[model samples]
Target chain A: MSTVTLHKVCKTFGEGKLAVHALRDIDLEVGNGDFVCLSGPSGSGKTTLLNMIGGLDRPTSGEITVANQRVDQMDKGELAEIRLRNIGFVFQAYNLIPVLSARENVEFVMQLQGIPPEIRHQKSKEILAEVGLNGMEDRKPAELSGGQQQRVAVARALVSEPALILADEPTANLDSVTAEKLVELLRHLNDEHGITFVISTHDKMVMGHARRLLKMHDGKIIDDIQQR
Target chain B: MGIVFHLAWRNLWRNRRRTWLTAGAIAFSTILLVLWVPIQFGAYEIMINASLAVFPGHAQIQRPGYQEKPKIRNAIDNAETLAKKLRASNQFVGVATRAQGFALLSSGTRSYGAQVVGVEPVFESGTSSIPGLVKKGRYLSGIDAQEMVIGAALARNLKIKIGDEVTLIGGGKDGSVAAAILPVVGIFESGSNELDRFFSEIPLHTFQNIFSMGHSAHAIAIVGKTVEEQDSLLTALRQETKDRNDIVILGWEQLVPGLKEGIQVDKVSGFIFYGILIAVVVFSILNTFLMSVLERTREFGLMLALGSRPKRIAMLMMLESTLLTLMGLIIGMTIGSALVYWVHIVGFAYPGMEDLAQQYNMPGLSRLYPQLDLFNFLIGPGSIFIATNIVAWIPVLRIRKLEPVEAMRTI
Candidate 1:
């Protein structure tokens, strides 16, 4: 179980005349097994907030702690180690390396974890099947469809069994039906495997599957609601 | 490290066009450098050997000031003692003594100053390759007293034929005018014009008796067992002559400083040629690498997001460039080696340039043949790879500044 705590975190771009606040005084907490969805329109700083929580970006001010480690104080290499050991990411465009096969992509995170090849193979295979890519493990990303590639990416994110899976607009490019299926898959993993998932999305289909919804506007979380 | 290399390999292939272009640039530069090696060093070796063939040996033992002035006073007086010392040393194959002086040649109304050397036909011919350069008539022989062999240019300038008699006039040590009438037994052509037009060979006794030097000669020429043994031969000669107050020993290269200077000048010129080629090629390589880096920015960013560190990305780029340059170097060296081998066997021949070569009295043939110096060849390609790696760093510096989010979002 992991908890991401953000206390008065602020992010600013440039300095002086060109200073633009990307995130402002953001305090939030995400608990273990929580299916949290961050919803906002473009430039609402939702992605920035998710990146800060995932240790992909640092807050210009204040503190962030994830799974008991002080992320704000960690150097780049230390943060990378944290991400490798505890965090997984899924991008809107899937972010699957086109040159690698499905199983190779899934095994990439496990490789970073220094898992033995045999264990990585078995885990990758199992995760690929879990994401509905059973026989497509050997295919490269370019050879897979939009939906199938997203599934492979999802498999990659979960294969490491990270404490937190942070996805930025994970189903943004998929059709509604595919998006629904992906949201359902993430929600099922959270419910069944107790995997903490923080997804940033504009798709209503994704937010509807969230156990808790956080709304953002002008770099601030304006609303938070717990779904029945 | 292995993972970084794995991604580096794929990154190189991801943009096939850029990668190939960069590789081509590297290969072309490498070939240019490799080709330069043989041509530059070959010219130098040929020129140096030609100069040494006519004037110096692998090492020379002379009276202290004899090379500066070939008059009778500079002749080695204790020649028997020097010859005995030299012959005892294992470093020399043979030591040949000769008397060198200046003479004014006259054929009809035409006249020119010449450097005349009286040589012991057998010993001189054995020490140097000069006798092998004769293009017409026979070279001087042991019993051919009062007979002279003139260079082709000297023969042409004197308007003298093989059977013609030429007069050599010069001052003796006793203020007496020493003169001799000698029949030209042979005409020789040593390809360099400077040597051919100014040098003549006669029997040593005739010069020794005419100059009143009493069996003494200007210098002793020592030929080594092989070209690589020159230094050892010189060192041995120096040690042998250590107790002699009047004798000085010097290496062949030092005997002809002009030839060494010419080679150094040629080496510098050759570097300029390869430098320009490398500059053009390295610029293109830089361009290709920069474009490739830009194209892969998003991929790099994605990898970073997936937990690939910035340092890992830089390592990946560096490995890819190194691999590309190494491939280019290997291919270029292969092609260059083939060309070097072919030229070394067949030699270069310029049929119509014989007259031009004759005018210069060049020691070799009309064609400029390249020397197959393996060390020079290796140095050429090795330097190219080093240069490529240095040039390849331009792109890596840019990657080091890459922010993960910025790289991921780069289109």
Candidate 2:
């Protein structure tokens, strides 16, 4: 069974002479528990494709299916619900809510899912510990380092146990060692938890960890390579 | 929802100085409203009571057309008997019968035209301030004393001193000459130029005898214990005289001429001032929340992308505003109530207020005591809470229109 399927997906930005085609006729499928990497240069539409699959942005044309639900046809509220129930997003900026502490940031999605407090607390604690952030659960995002904040973001994304995690340059701001550690953590989660991941990155180390890689240039996918 | 509240509260303190400043503005406005509303109302109460004490007690009963025209012919027959019954009811503090006629008084060729009121001396002292305000000599001694208490201004105009005999001449109720030679027993200064210059009082029986009014008087002035009792007293008075169509009951508002209109004008002006104050505070709230929302655009986009609905984001902002307003209201009400209560107990007087009150002929109005009932206490803070929430919606509504893709790019 496929966790994500994209058919002839096209995204255009702006209009008239100023229009930029950010994604063009993209057809791809990721099997359940597949670890996929999308690799490209700056304007190669890697982030846009991730956005389309996560239901964060709508395509100018074509259909996108994630976890067997049509993503392109859903309303904003429905899209939000689909993301809540099936997809977890990790942004490059390590977008942890600044007001929330590390544990609370991880528990935020569960709270929105109406999980009970005892369970949410226990789960959040376990996830933060797994991310090696034990004893730092009470520290706010500003109190954490770059690598720690990114780990917190990853903890938040994984805590809800969604079927697919879409990471957009998740390690771009981290040093090579931290970035390698984060990729290792993602690989461990993918291997042990059977959680599918489609990561958009320019890092060779991150691309090397993926079971499959898709290379793109000028909004068009140029090559698909299966490595493991 | 509790998490949302928690989040909202935490967000409010992200910029602690800004939050405190905004809440402090709200608190200041609340304090102003809480104190000013009661004080203004207190002043109005003092003004009413002082004005009523000068003559028109809380209410009056007059022969139907007498309030408008006040001709001697339009007099209430058996007015003394009616006043005695009203006084017996124990509903009023004082009830006095009075007869009034326009008369010309002369002392050695110096003359003045004054409305000569005939009052029952014993009851008049309880019901009217004039008897207590005698600056010279004494108030009239009996119901038929043939003695007069004239205003000081009238005495100066007529060149008559106490113990001097003055001749009053007027057309009688029976179409005959109403003439009298009476001694000026007292000179009272009422502080009002109109009352002091044009008003004089003789005994009610003396007035009836001289005017050929035969057991008839113009009005029965009734004084209640407090101004708040006026309405129920008026209702009871109306019921008491319901069958007697020859008379009308008038409350102080009606009896005092422009007093009601004056209070209404003052109230509207007060509301305008308060409105300006509320507008200023509401704009401050708007500015604070708008800035908060604008600065948190990326954070909101992150939340949206994390599967939080737009309404939840809006609710978070509203909860922040609600919490801020509640904090301000509690602090303001606490401080304001203490201050108002202290002033209410000890009383408040402005500089030169006594002299000013006397100058305006409202002498008892020198000291104002604020009345802080539930209405006055909550009105100010309640308005702020509601206005803050309403103003906050301006920024909060923008969250509903936010697209995660667009909002995430705001930074």
Against the true structure, what is each candidate's TM-score? Answer: 0.89, 0.97
What are the chain B TM-scores of all models? 0.85, 0.96
Candidate 2 A-chain TM-score: 0.98
Clashes of each: 10, 0
Give the per-residue lDDT digits (tens) of candidate 1, residues B7-45.
667767887887777777777777766766886677666
- Per-residue lDDT tens digits for candidate 2, residues B1-411, read 767878999988989999999889988998899988999899889988988988988988998777888788998889999998888888788999999899999999898899999999999976788998888999999998889999989999999898999999999999999999999999999878889998999998999999999999989999887888777889889877777888989888878879989999999999899889999999998999999999999999999999999998998899999999888888888888888998898889989988866654455677899976789788888888888999999999999999998899888
Query: Chain A TM-scores, all candidates?
Result: 0.98, 0.98
lDDT of each: 0.79, 0.91
> Which 10-residue window of candidate 1 chain B scores lowest in summed lDDT?
B356-365
List of clashing residue pairs for candidate 2: none
**TM-score (chain B) for model 1?**
0.85
Every model's Cα RMSD, please?
Answer: 3.3, 1.7
Candidate of highest TM-score: 2
Q: List the DockQ of the predictions in order.
A: 0.57, 0.88
Docking class of 2: high
